[model samples]
Target: MRRLLLLPAIALITTLTLIAPTHAADQPNFLVFVGDDMTWTDAGCFGNSEVRTPHIDQLAREGMRLTACFTPAPMCSPTRQALYTGLFPVRNGAHPNHSRIHEGLRTMPHYLGDLGYRVALTGKRHFGPNESYPFEFLGKNKNPDFDAIGKFVRDAGSAPWCLMVCSNQPHTPWNRGDAEAYPPQSLTLPPYMVDTPATRKGLSQYYAEITYMDGELGRCLDILDESGQRDRTCVVFLSEQGSSFPHCKWTLYDTGIKAAGVVVWPGVVEPGTTSDALISYVDLLPTMIEAAGSTPSDEFDGRSFLKVLDGSQQQHRETIFAVQTTRGIIKGSEAYGIRCVRDGRYKYILNLNAENEFSNTVSQDGNIFASWKRKARNDPEAAELVESYVRRPEVEFYDLESDPFELNNLAADPTPAQKDRMAELRSRLNAWMAQQGDDGAATEMQALERMSPRSADGYRRWRAQQRRSGADSAD
Candidate 1:
């Protein structure tokens, strides 16, 4: 693996001074836009002709498009925590969904705060312990408040600022856009998705929500332009995780963990460029810290990718790892703990509790999942896809170059070379787990026990109702 290059003290001082010669005391401001449950290929820039995302596409046309960005977890909270703390899920104590970070763990706000930057979050409070984050709470609304955000930016007169604008679009119960505009019949479903009326309808709604999110992004950009911060601020747009669909959200597949990333800094990053850097969400904090002219802490699980942003380096990470623990989700979802490691070509997954069938909120209540189940009764291929999703062996491997969607599992019958590669990846994953103090099942069980009894029982009833409504049936 290539290590991040660090400059000497004198060279670092010179670089910082040169980057901000006009306003030596003022560091560059950061404006980050995060989307919820959005896939890497959902926007127009990523080749999704069905979804209309003119604003996000414009960012790609005028900024740096990162092709291989991924999150540390498929779920929202875990991924957000990893991005905030630059720590993996286990180490950060937020491996499970709807979980909090370990006490006394510092976040991006603390790191940027020390560098004379005012860090504030405008949407989605999915993280906790007020002291650990301490972000100036700008407000929590799923939709972007352009006027308020503009006011906030304009108010940050001199001191550097880092503003996080999070959007809750394209998530579950997707009902925020003009669904009629995206006709179900005209949709192009992925190979992993079944073709049915319900599936198409669900996809159309999800695409519509994506378009809505894009419009929101446009609004934010307009606000920045109005505030005269477009040229001075480093704008970063991130698609947090994949959409809430089968084989997408809550899974370690490419559709689940992969994220779309774009960075626009007028004087720093070259416009209309694309980078194939293998960056994970865990690297965002460190990169932003370095971009703010501050040295990143050595305790971070990730390193600064400023070199990649500045076009001085091409590769960022040789491998990225992801984790999933369903203990804090609906009750009886304890069986869905998984860990995965992926490089440029291959991906290896280890389903920790593979003896039990995998079941989560998506599989139980998602419209696409319900549609898949309905289609499986008559379509053999759909039935096979459904079976593959619910039941899995202990280990699975995929040659991502050939099977980008991870449809084919190569672990069952591997050639000699494949076996060697699998062993190497397995060893790497084991070492990472040990270093993170990941006890897998034991940890998940403990998390489950920590949940309130009432909440657990409520979730159990909710899941039971879903099962009774034929949501879990393949007939």
Candidate 2:
């Protein structure tokens, strides 16, 4: 096994400097657009010809597109918390879906506030202990108040402001966009998905929702333009995660953790350029801090990727990590937790509770997956695909180049070189777990500690309802 170069992470960032305040005028304003459950490949800029995302395509033409951005955690709450806090989900104590952060953790608003920026978030905040994420919230709906966004940007005058606008489109119950625009028979499904009529309908609806989210993103960007802040503001668009489908939302596969990112920073970033630098959601906070003339704290699991923005550096991280805690999610796996490490090419997944069958809403309750099961009776390929979604080994490895969708596993009976690579990745993953105080299955067992009281109550209520109908699925 040849030793992989631990170039970026091995050396700790030590020269962190905190400059004096009054930096509002000198620093630039920032506006971030977040989309819910949007698959990266669906965006026209990323390589989809069917799903029309004209706004995202326009942004890509005027900015740099990120080809290898991923969230540290796949679920909504964990991903949002990690992005806001600049800490991995487990370390921040928000590893589970519908979870809350550990008390006393200072998030992006705190750090950016200290740097003289009025940080605010509008729409779809799935974090908790609300104080931890102290951004001047503009609205509480799934979509942003465009009037409020415009007023906020225009009111800031010369003072630097940071606003993150989130959209709830393209999530489950995908009903936001015009399904008519995407014909069921004309759409091309990903190779991983089953091609049944139900699957096509679901995918078409998903794509429609994506187009709707793109419109939402365009609205935010349009606000900046109307406010005359477009040139001065660094606009960032992020497609949160994959849509709700089999082998996507609740797993650590690329489709689950990978995200789409585009940035437009005038005079700094080159237009129409794309980079393959790996960026984790945790890196956003420190990047914001560094961009504002302050140094990133050593405590951040991610460092500033501002250099990637400025075009000074082409690479950011040698390896990126992700967490998937199926506990506490709606129709989730009881205790199936996953951890994985990926570099430029290969990936290693450690399924902590692999003995238990993996089950989620897509596999058990969704119409699309039911179609898959129905088709499986007559289609061997559909049967194989359906079976793979719910069952897995303790270890899974993939050569991403050969398997972009992660369809094949290379962990069992691997070649000597493949074994070495897997071992090396596993070693790094173990070190990361230790650093986050993530005791694998032990950490997963304490998920209730991380889940918020409200979320837990809701889960109990749902379980009770299931019992009343004589269809209780609680284990």
Candidate 3:
């Protein structure tokens, strides 16, 4: 009887061990720290001397750092829309900020939830208005409060949780007078912008905001560690687009598209590993799905770079694309706008209407109209930056290797070799745009057609009303 009892006990112990969850520990929690209106070199991990982001730097030290990452669009709404839908901004009628993301889109979090991962988002979740257009992926609502994020995670009642945290800071109305903390002279203004006291003064506030953002992220990371989820969590930190600088925010240049990307997955991704893989906003969704051990559907335009995380592949993209939209700047003026294709060495811009009324003037200044106009007059560097705003030839090219600042335009050169490279990039752009269903100025046409007489008249009436209201209020 004793032997028989012992035999059943042994069998029970074996069964319990075998039935334990295999992915309980292996499946990593997901946390994405998205900064609003940040530039490419804003983080300490990305080699910025003025910025002090110790927590973000620590994340890079604990995981893989991705260089050469670009956003699909320069603007926030379209870029975030494309990143979530895994489609180009044009496909969903989100060419610019005014257009909302279409309803019933299959987003990353929407699909991940089906795979047993709990998903949540907090802070600056710019997924367009939910009343007009809803996303299948977002849980609860868009832009959930920061305090609510932790509560949602705890209530998930699951082992692995995915949280998307976006912070809005360092964009505009910058914290002035804070430039004193950073060496004002050491601020490396982009070659396109002038080195002036005002520029440095603006940067000082921007840096302070970045530092403040860093503190917020540090708090979240500390919470994760305290909850014993550090080892089982994968953290990705990046920005939506560039800062509020002239010629960068709304343009396809490095200032607008290129961003600092850092990922941390302890024990899985090797720490201190840096890869120059040309990553884009499109790659984020597919990569996150893969990390969750789930396969994305064929609908996605991006591919998973699991090899890069494992240190097997060195680079991902050889070339990247950029789009610009200026439909609202001028009324009844519809232009197909500028489309650019950039490799590591060169950038080719196709101004669909170079000679017509829809000409692409020095297309770099995408900031607020007030700030942009001021910079052009007061800042000498602004003049050089907006040089392309002038009427251009059908095509323009810049050799980024030698002229990283993009001061010289070589399209006018009579050299045969330069002409050949220009032709090649043009062909590539045309082909890619055609494939994406974004040939020429179709975006501009959509914008014009959609803008009704009522909307236009409403804007005009609102402006006049505002003036009258201001006068009356002052009295």
Candidate 4:
């Protein structure tokens, strides 16, 4: 395992020089590649020698690797919406899966376009209302048209542009890269998982998909290089949200919301640099805006980390917050809502519907959870883990420095110091929700109202069916 060295109030680059903002005509180009369902720890640069991610590794070696980057929500739609809109999920009215933003919300393209830049998002768009996004759509889900990307760059000539290439790899069905490269017996499972043969097999396939996503990222980077704009382009790649494995997706665990963030700003960010500065997805657009030598608006939920990029600042945010809504997702729990807040070390989680079983598609048939249960019948360790997965306490706290995987919950018997920390974090979390107009469980039940037209209708029928079947979700 490769560990990221913690830098203490050091310069972003070796020079420790603060980069002066460039003129509007000389603004650099931006190229962003977002991978689907990839946990930060699995990123080769972050650690994990089992998977292949040469392209991502190269970026970390030549760029700044953000240690505490996170999304506003664990699911796809809310994460993407928050990233683009520069607002938290609830504030944007898209806190649920398959949800849409409020009618008049503006996004990245709008902000960047006003600054005279061509902004386009290609592939795997979970956003909606064309007016809100307004990106020049390029390709379909999972498949970004590389040729079109190259052509778009060539056609842009000297105009500064920001392009986001979204990928749909390593999500589900786990069939992308070559699984043979990673033998099931040779892999070391994360501590949170059960070491069943079925789990190993699924891990192998999931790893292959991760590598496949890296390959796609390589292609996107190659386009920038081929265009001779590599130096003038700031290349960034983010592992958007965690994988759908248990304790990863559909939860507020660090593994679920932690994003793999690497930024390669040529002549600006130092090579092989690492920053422990915490940043949220909502902060990205504001950072980009500042990078373009423009001012970010006060209405945004995030502040620009451009100073952090140029060695002018060390930390970005005081704490990061995330939410999880299970009402509209496929095979998700009826109203199991979760919220979390984390600083550098401690993480606090609140499960609003703690009485309900924490359920998701991960425990469905053919998934790894069933296999764990089968082994749990005879193995006490497996049984304990299986029980812990579905049954969680309402208030959970973990010292992230000591327990990175979050196996031990300190909330059960908190020390005086721990109790004080928890109270502070819980108070901050409540204040954040109040600002977003979130009423905890009540906000969760109204998820369909924020969903896209297509997703809203489907979930309405599903809710109706659940009612007919005597499954009262309290919706």
Candidate 5:
């Protein structure tokens, strides 16, 4: 396993100087395609043979592929807030799902708009508080509108633009594509997943949705080509967080926080290159700021990785952190809180409230969970997986190189060196929590208090109504 060396502040300043700006007329436009609830290895380029993602694979072949990219949060709104603000979810005040950011914190629009760039967001506006992210809203639709996006790009005239196209695909109550195309019997399942009829069927639907998203990506790239901006544009495709399944979406495991990232900036990046630099979604805002020829703010928790993009740096950060809080979930769900720290090869997790059995939206009402339980009745391995999904220990550690699925907990049987490493990771996580003003139990209590008593009841009623109407209620 390769380890990352932490750069000194003075060295970072010097590296920033190496990123020169393009010509005034040739400033690169940024087009970011964010896939909701998609896991790290679902695309064709990421080694999934079952899912067909020709467009994303093509982008990898034409651009730079990041082998390891993680998000600050596994859920939707929290991750989006962190990505736009360059701050962790705890500091941004959107640590819980479906939550808003802090009142006065600025977003990418505020930072990039000051540099004479137009930032616009189309489709899925999961973020809130119009003032925090005052981007020009092009439109909102689950599906892509290539014609309108092309028009938006062309109308920008000579000014550079940053457009975020958020796609609501591969999310649950999956049903958006032709599920018949992906046969459940022929699909390959991950080690963390149980082999059952319902699990296979659910995974096939999810794969179909990923393929649909790929087609939409192809359409967006076509729009860029037709508009003649493909050469001067930086295209980024991000697989946001993980899918909504057991041991994936809501957990702080690698499967939950790790994301797939690909970037294609014509003149700045080499074609068909792969980078093993460690990066987080919070670093994206600062990178784009530097790419647009502007100085990044000192207040951001993330530093720019433009040097990595320019082929001048092999490493970015020595460690990355992730957080999760299940307070605002539906009624009867346990308030599970998790904090994690990971270096290149090892991961350490602290389950803040591990006394209570964990339960969330994903584990309760999905056919996938139903199938897992059904299989658990006859299979001991499936029973263990199901039990581990809900009953977690106070602390867990894993050497990711040896156990990528993180099934084996090494907290109890660490060697002397592993014990020291675990202590170091714990110290780092504690210091980060202090910096973010994260008082674990108190924070969870506050989030719980903020949730109205009627909110959970309302959510239950909404789910019932959706079931009656045959609508998707998997948010």
Candidate 6:
């Protein structure tokens, strides 16, 4: 809750004079590499030995690795919206994948374009619900060829450019029998779930995807090296959300919301400087704008961390926030919506509606805890816990420091003196929601839970745009 307003000149001075060699007019080319559905502990730098993310790990070794970075939402579309607009997903009305970003808002790439930076994107541009508003130059796809990345950077013709490359490997539809590529025995399982052989096998597949994405990252980095822009370019590696997993990915757990972020710029970010400083996905836009000497819009809730790049700023946010969208089905129909928040140590989830009734009873792949349910039916303890979570409690709380796995709930437990802390946090969160004009967003989010991507307003908008395009062609 520290006020940036109190240190006005400090923020200005830090923004203006942080970078050394660059003149007031010189702008650095920007590049953001978004890894799809990646997690903090999955990367080599963060501590997963089995999952090979050598290139991303190398980027961390060469620059700064953020330990406590999180996206506003645990899912892809909402967090991507926040990243582009520097606002919370709820504030932008992009709470769920089916929801569209308000049309007139200036996006990060749009702002850069106005500043004379030729903007181009390659791979997953899942913005505006159905991803309707891709950059005019490049549309969304899986991964851009390494040779193409090099060609684009080299042929930028002395003008500054911004390129965003995204990938979608580590998501769902797990690779079943690739034991040689990713040995199941070598993988580690999170504590929230029982570490069975099946879990390990699933994890192995996710890691295989991680390894594949690492190769892609290496290709892009190699392209930058060959183009001779590696030194001058400011490279940022981040994720839209966490990997798709049970109680992760689409959920609001740390495994679902937190992402690995690393920034490398030879002389700018100090080597091997790891910071636990909190960073929101929303901050990317302002940071890019500030680094390039472009003005950020007043509506932006995020602040630039360019000082952190120049070794002048050590702290980012003291407390970070997070949210997730819920999914549901009603008599063959679908619904979706959600909103939540987290401080550094505790995560507070306020579900406006019950998960079972408000959304689908099954997971993304329609695996309604098939293995877990079988085990739970046999084990009384597991059955009790599963039943509790399934009932869709109004509030959930966890002590991240002690229960990093987030299996134990302190919201209803009186043994931990949690009620007082919970009340204080609830007050703070409610006040924040009100200030953002989202007093009933939690309730509205419940309505969204039952909505599907096909039924979303965003899809309608996309269809209308397509119709207009068709009409213009006819003319």
Model 1 lowest lDDT segment of ten: 1-10
**In order, what lDDT does every prediction score?**
0.81, 0.85, 0.66, 0.85, 0.82, 0.67
- The model with the greatest TM-score is 2
How far residue 381's Cα lies from its native spot in candidate 5, in Å, is 0.5
How much is the lDDT of residue 352 in candidate 3? 65
Q: Considering only N, C-alpha and C atoms within 3 Å, which residue pairs clash in candidate 3?
A: 110-137, 247-364, 247-365, 336-441, 361-388, 361-389, 362-388, 362-389
Q: List where candidate 2 sits over 4 angstroms from the true fold.
A: 1-17, 460-475
TM-score (all chains, Cα) for each model:
0.91, 0.94, 0.81, 0.93, 0.90, 0.83
Q: Where does the lowest 10-residue lDDT sum fall in candidate 3?
A: 12-21
Sorted on TM-score, best first, the list reads 2, 4, 1, 5, 6, 3
Residues 13-100, candidate 4: write the lDDT tens digits: 1322223346556688899999999888997889898899999999999999998899888899999999998888887778898878
- Model 5, stretches more than 4 Å misplaced? 1-23, 448-475
Q: Candidate 6 lDDT, tens digit per residue, 1-475?
A: 1233223212321333222225423778877888888776888898877777889989998999988888888767778878877877666667666456654565665567667677777877666633334454444356565556777888986778888887776766655224477777766666655455666666777788778777778888888887777778888888568775566666677877888989998778998888777788888888888777765644566878778777787888766666555532211112234456667777777765454333233331244355666678778765754565445577888889998767777777745467777777788777766655564544353435324555555544643564566631221
Query: What is the Cα-based TM-score of model 5?
Result: 0.90
RMSD of 2: 4.5
Alpha-carbon shift of residue 267 in model 6 (angstroms): 1.3
Report the poorest 10 consecutive residues by lDDT, candidate 2: 1-10
User: How many residue pairs clash in all the candidates, one count each?
Assistant: 0, 0, 8, 0, 0, 13
Model 3 C-alpha lDDT versus the unseen true structure: 0.66
Model 3 earns a TM-score of 0.81
List, residue by residue over 85-134, the lDDT tens digit for candidate 2: 78888888899998988777777787788787899888898889887788
Cα shift from native, residue 179, model 3 (Å): 4.6
C-alpha lDDT (0 to 100) for residue 359 of candidate 2: 67
